[model samples]
Target: MENSLLVETISCTDGSLVGIATLNRPQALNSLDLEMTRILDKALKDWSQQPEVVAVIFRGAGEKAFCAGGDLHSLYDTMIEYKGQPASANEHANRFFAEEYELDYLIHTYPKPIICWGDGIVMGGGMGLMAGCSHRVVTETSRLAMPEINIGLFPDVGGSWLLSRSPGHTGLFLALTGALIGASDAIYCGFADHALARDQWEPLLQALQSTPWARTAEDFQKVTDLIHALPSIELQTGPLESHRALIDRICQEYDLERIGVSIAALSQNEDKWLSRAGQTYMNGCPGTARLSWELLRRARHMSLADIFRLEFGVAVECAAAGNFQEGIRAVLIDKDRQPKWEPATLEETAGDWMAPYFALSIDDPSHPLATLGR
Candidate 1:
């Protein structure tokens, strides 16, 4: 699938090279399938070893999205085939998640600067990839979220860690509501570093190519300076900022049950944004809400590697359950927008109900992501 991931090397002014990886499945919003994931991981690995490659830029091919999410269609198929089995029993999910997490971790710990052009829709796995990049650029069109709750999945791909770090309890609010936020909100949440007009992408690329490159700390600083030199775009205030007070107050509760009631009550508010977020939470998978909250809490203190390991198990366990499959079926296959979560309600998923998701599903002594951050 050469078309899936178009890898290129652009010669810089000083004879150094800038590696570019473009996610090419624009029709599908560049969603990562297993093959695309493998291609990207290999490309990144190869670039890391090439000293002449001073930096890497990741972007999707289309104007509509950088990447909407992962290849849910494929994951849905895998889940259907291995229904009722533990995460260890679902080999494809395990490998897909394992490789994806490894790829994300690599971006986080990459030896060189990585610029992620986060234009258009960036959510779920897309959020993961962008969050790892050192230079995260958002355009006027950038719309971001960790909306796994909608699909019966918690925010994987380092989302737990990413969300946990959001200002105040806005992270908890996002995890529970699957809210759609703009570039400003994304930047406010620390999901993006720079905000540029969409057209600046080309100019930014040209600037990068023209700069004298050095594969060192200077390169990272230069990349940052170049991006900062680009013309800025002023976006309208996003809901996250406007509703910060309310969001923080609602999520401040230590008990998720109390938080759920507060969030669900927003549906009746006169403000459409708050009401919509509230409705989304009300309609989302109870299991996902539970997992997202629990994971975000745990990720607050764990090392990045540990978060990935913990998410791997939760992802696999999600595959074993019916909610993930049903969420996919309704949202993607059936297009019905209805998912019947097994636990049925937040009240039902309380306490140790999430214990199984935290447990390692595989028998291997060496965890799949054990090599991360080593």
Candidate 2:
């Protein structure tokens, strides 16, 4: 709309248009800007209504990332302006999350198949894009994580839905520690369905064009089967295998101090991955950690619509009072690596200071996503 070309749509041989939505900002890791989200929401909404558009393919332009996440710089700036008040803040924070969550919910309930080529780093907003697709593919080099805690944000891109259902307490551990997992772990956690060798990606793309399309009852299955038919990839069992027991132990304890202390203890682990993960939790914003834990707990039984609503509420609240601004300043703007969280300790992050985040105002029953999963 702004002539920025944030998303490019390509016509497929399947007929009128088998939408291929490419995230075009490679320099920024194809991150989702407000412009990009608006473009994607418009294009996908248009394509969803057209009968000739059999399926949609989502991918990134760069070699390094499918999408690292949403453009946090924009969010940081907007939050600074809005700061969580419903009346005026709704103009930015409310609208952004509302549109974003609407798009995510659409992807989940889409009648036609959606294929997300998860090639490289996929986190935060990136995870949101891939999570709802019917066919999700991972390459040998795919690096995936929720990683919201690092920025003083919970995994809002349907993170609560995906992570809550992860095997054992692995999701909780990942949410709090911002753990990065590989292709195999993605499949193990139900994040991805198929593995395609990086070298064979070209072949997969070619096959997509040559494949026949029909709006049959089994259209979704047919698309998924096509992707699965690609050459198999050998995925190494990453950290999840070795750290399963420890993650279960750490996450089963819901108390902020207990879980935080247990994970922080891993800072001394022999394994660098575990040690870094531990250090991440040891230093992450106390409010974000507690909020993530609560969301994951509540998400275990909520519907997809409810999860979106809940995430919207938390995101707005984070923008308003949580340490997200401080986190972004230290982690991105200042590069100082020192965020002064208000309630700096996990113990202090519990109780009233964290209540408003879970409460709903704009994200209530009359919310934009009320009929999301219906």
Best by TM-score: 1
Candidate 1 Cα deviation (angstroms), residue 103: 0.1
The regions of model 2 sitting more than 4 angstroms off are 1-16, 83-90, 361-366
Estimate, for each residue in 1-374, the C-alpha lDDT of model 1 and write its tens digit. Answer: 44788899998888899999999999999998888889889999999899999999999997899999899998888898888776788889999999999999999999899999999999888999999999999988888988888888899999999999999999989989999999999999899999999989889989988998767889899999999888899877888998999888899998989999999999999999899999999999999998988888888998998889889999989988888888889888999897887888999999888888877833335788877776
lDDT agreement with native, every candidate: 0.89, 0.83
**Model 2 worst lDDT window (10 residues):** 1-10
Candidate 1's C-alpha runs over 4 A off are 361-364
Q: What are the per-residue Cα lDDT tens digits for candidate 2 across 19-95?
A: 87888888888888777788888988898788877778888886999999988887788777766555335457777
Model 1 alpha-carbon miss at residue 216, Å: 1.4
| RMSD of model 2 against the true structure | 2.2
